[model samples]
Target: MSSVCSTFISSSALSIKPKCANPSRSRSKLRINCTVGDVFVFSESVIEQKAVSTAEPLLVSAVRGENVERPPVWLMRQAGRYMKSYQIICEKYPSFRERSENVDLVVEISLQPWKVFKPDGVILFSDILTPLSGMNIPFDIVKGKGPVIFNPIKEAADVDKVREFVPKEYVPYVGEALTILRQEVKNEAAVLGFVGAPFTLASYVVEGGSSKHFSKIKRLAFSKPKVLHALLQKFTDSMAKYIQYQADNGAQAVQIFDSWATELSPVDFDEFSLPYLKQIVDTVKQSHPELPLILYASGSGGLLERLPSTGVDVVSLDWTVDMADGRRRLGPSVAVQGNVDPGVLFGSKDFITNRIMDTVRKAGSGKHILNLGHGIVVGTPEENVAHFFEVAKGIRY
Candidate 1:
């Protein structure tokens, strides 16, 4: 009898071969024939369950501080504009919201990187502000202008209008995509889910989208602290639920992106960002203790020591900090990811290899996830990225 696996059938599905980096490995052991769609039906054979390959993904093991051969590798925006395949998809579906919110498009976009790079983790292709529309805040991801909030929350009344996020109702596509990604990747790699941290979410909603100085949010924080606090509270409760939803729906680990949290001074971060992050971490921990939570704050060199206090299992560092120093500062209590400059990918192959080796060595043996300090920049040489993963995979303790 042949084993079976769930497969989504649709016109948009792309046929691709499974990972067989070593030609010696039999196709039967690794194949997971799947496609991108919503209507699900079983295919001929499931991803094989081989006795030797059943161990948990290296990413999960490393996150738990378990000793492993080397750090598992994946990039922040591994499945976005940088890929030619993704760009083709984007051309067909020009609307960012359409591409990201639809289940079929989400699954296809998320798997594009997996198909080529075979990164150790496959993250869902969605946005941090995805929940905003569900939260009663109308928004759009304009092509060039970026996120555009129809009505920016300015006063106390706006806080009351902001609803708590209900992930299943608001973003069912997210759950569906993650579930499909799990079957597609199997234990070969971990499936990752993510959400925007409260303050960062609040920043977008409050500032009406991306801001240069973030003056409006700071003004609210300084003058009407209570109002800002109210907004943060709603986001905190909603994001906690969002994290739990992602984990329960096949996400092996969830990353909390606090991209704008570092915009606040240490003193302000403690007041606006830190406590809310702690609340989300605490809320999720009670329900899903085994679910690893990773926190990332862009340009976080000033707040490295304080990140672990949120109780996340891993802390991701941007390129501003040295990997060795970041590892020391973050300490051994939490695992570490990133610190490589994404620009390194634009350099010569040898230069990229050396940087990968340097970061891995500085990160030490276990409790590390190799990644770029930030998302892969647009116009990056795809060949160099291939080199990055090639060198990273070849590393041995």
Candidate 2:
């Protein structure tokens, strides 16, 4: 997620039946396309459970479903626009790419939240689309317009131009910054690296930028399925390598952000989003088996059970889903993170404290990571955020 993102699916919209299909399919032959969203009624499927590796960092340990006295606490966009320190840095360096691509600036901004809040996870101050240029998808983050792709991909020819990302070649700064963050934090917290899930990145490239209604991507999905599938496949391979690149460099854990996954109905999500996500998880697991992989899809109340089928280590919940219900759906096999409304920080400290306690109690004990349901909204009080960390860290089982 960027500093700001939008959700397309309304909670009241047609709900996906909890009955799920096999969401995990390898890359060799993924012909998951169906009649848009009318496909999956979800029948029971076997879910493979990976043994949780023991790790030092609290976030890693907690994600592994380890026995921890307190669940790790970190916000989705902890190192972001809301922080005054980041605002000061943004003023100095006006360019989003410059701030994110420059090793020194990225390191400084990523550590800003860590220094002030001492979060359990220190996510890299980078965007999900940071690797686009390396993949031959030229883009820029505009002030009010958000991301703008110079040439939006639509045809078979356009998809061919999008190259497989060589992370060390295109985004060395990211790897270097992650390495430095690991050294600085010294295992006190997990250093997170993230990539946009295929469907989400494809949205930016296909639609030219963020859309209030994702009509273009939907059109491609409905009308020209092959074209969209080709694009998604390219991203699937590129991102798998990107995750491995980040893990090899120094990232303790990596999060996959499918910000636009909710835009598609559950049936459509299986075809367009799930297979590629499972492929990425599968690829990363081959090498970095112990490294924790987390997936976030905003407003994913209906898709909770379907997420674990993708084989991710942890499934991050949005505020729309209750923490307890989310925990129960994901089961003990998958670790759970988030469900606290980011808007809660705007409330009084007592309200904030009460919500945290309620979420914690409902989440029960092990395998829980405390975080905002979504990114911390712009203009959140720094004091309340500090209090969030204070109260969350103070809790004990």
Candidate 3:
């Protein structure tokens, strides 16, 4: 019922305006008349049968369950410490806050990986905690100690002090940066925007910083469930609006990082994390139904099945789960991204190639995004990261 643009492999560059409904077959002989640019080069074989819109980014198409030649590729933290260029920038701008908050710096840091690797997705360089300060929660990313909350919230009164996020007023730089990124990337890649999930954001503010045992947040969850729920609600509302704001500002897709939610038991996660996540997803979908929403939780092997209930378009896996198992477990309703070990980059180039092939093969043909299970490690070889993208882009269905 929808009109979409598709490129055919004929003599010249032909942009065909075609109206095609989603075919019933998962793998159909008919080629989909949807525009997936140079980043996704499909072979003569059939494409997946999901309804797609007009020429969108390859990552957007892949996540929408549309059949593409190969899965779109982008790492979780593709724009961080691993690159020499990023390190050089860090030397100049010592403060992580300065690097992430300033519009020019955010755009430059975000595009660093895009320039070098030409990733299919150029995610915002801002931190999940970037919005915390705007929400009346003071925090800082210390060089060695990681994130530090000035005053950890432990009670109802502290939760009361948390202000609702006003992205335009507080973080207009985020919107500006995303707008610029979209202009830079054009139709070649998806400009990804991300926010920390309510539970994870709550964890950071509740625990005061990163924690190994996570006892502080768990204590608050187990003992003072009401207080934790109150805080989570505030974050849920704020982040849902934040996603909308990003999408309105030209972010093609937005990912929700629930990095610390895996620490909870299934029962606890259901009570604390699931509802808030679902609320955020439901809220965003109501307004931006076409925007792809991705949810990621590190070490989420145990929580895979529960993830789909949140209604996100994609579920990113950590390395603990096998690609084959993750694909089978998540089924076809949700697209899958990642599960490659970041440490694999340290292995030989042949090993990295084999792993990429193995993951691609296991993920089957459609609805996959080749990525590291987690962020590229601090010491990951830049050449290997380049190799990861090279092998990934060369894959065909």
Candidate 4:
């Protein structure tokens, strides 16, 4: 394995500069103090660079089933809320509301995770509600409510009233952020973009926010199947276009966040949720065949059997399920990501290390992507995060 030794440099020490070679393969110089034995091994596939920036593609070939010595790692919601640097940057702005709303701030926060973690990828910093906000849905992030909608979609007309798809300008913020992240990240890591799945987005819009029972959405799905499908279809069309937009600009991969997909019974999921998800995935694939697509469904232990039918390149499991069990059920074709309970991060370093090792062992020898089963809970000790990666780096397939 190739290695480099150097003194650690602060993330800010790296500067993004204009590229003279192919934009996708260009490298920038970064200087760090280091010793003779300090080693860094990059995938032979990555173009060597003197300095790292967002311009280099994140190491996605591993996720696509390519073998490499070091396993790639990145966290869900790696950007914002979790990092002190992100918090400090946000403080410079007036409010969390103002900071998240601004595209430039969003890009800056998104890059913060990359700077700190040096993860294999950078997920875009925007929330799932961004597209809805662009659609003029009148939504806001209430402290406990998650997302509160001023006007919920109760009927077909309400769905019709909202534009069926995102207009380019309304959400140009995402594209702008991607462009900056692409240039800033360079080949050091891959940049990921995401959208809420149709059913999940519909759940927030239909239920008017977060829900424990999802009674309203369930009732609508069963009682007014046509209306639900219509809404789902519209959202599917919009999400497909949204994901494609990200891929077009520079995202190496995209994820569909079906955070609420676990709430449905398998039968209901097949009827109400899977169809629209298939629609979006299929449509997006038509346009960007090579882009990796990850479909993450939280609390989806019961529906693991049905996931393979969805056509997602990767399936992200929640913490409750055993990784080995999920691998067996989902079979060998799909790459498996995550299943470590975020709560585990709050425990002792030994506990976290043991758990991560167990997960790596259970994942067996096939395509596997390392990630938290869910997001990193805010206020987690940063040392725990570091230990998780440290242990993960030591594991062998």
What lDDT does the true structure give each of the candidates? 0.84, 0.82, 0.84, 0.74
Candidate 2 per-residue lDDT, tens place, 1-397, comes to: 1100001011112232222223445543222211112322111111121223344888888887777867889998888789888999889999999999999999999999888878889999999988899989899998877999999988889998988889999999999999999888877788899999999999999999898899999999999999999999999999999999999989989999999998899999999999999999998999889989999999888888899999999999998898888988888899989879999999876677667767776787788899999999999999889777766765555
Which one wins by TM-score: 2 or 3?
A: 3
By TM-score, the better pick of 1 and 3 is 1
Tens digits of per-residue lDDT, candidate 1, 1-397, equal 1121211111112232222122222554433333222211122211222233457988999999997876889999988788889889989999999999999999999998877877889999999999999999999999989999999999999999998789999899999999999888888889999999999999999999999999999999999999999999999999999999999899999999999999999999999999999999999999999999999999999999999999999999999999899989988899999978999999876667567766776788789999999999999988888767755665556
lDDT of 3 by residue, 185-214 (tens): 887889999999999999999889998899
Comparing 1 with 4 on lDDT, the higher-scoring candidate is 1
Provide the global lDDT of candidate 1 against the true structure. Answer: 0.84
Q: In model 4, which range of ten residues has the least summed lDDT?
A: 1-10
By TM-score rank, best first, the candidates go 1, 3, 2, 4
TM-score of each: 0.87, 0.86, 0.87, 0.84
Please give the clash total of every predicted structure, in order: 0, 2, 1, 23
Candidate 1: regions farther than 4 A off: 1-52
Among these predictions, the greatest TM-score belongs to 1
**Backbone clashes in model 1, listed as residue pairs:** none
The alpha-carbon root-mean-square deviation between model 2 and the true structure, to one decimal in Å, is 14.6
Pairing residues by index, what is the TM-score of model 1?
0.87
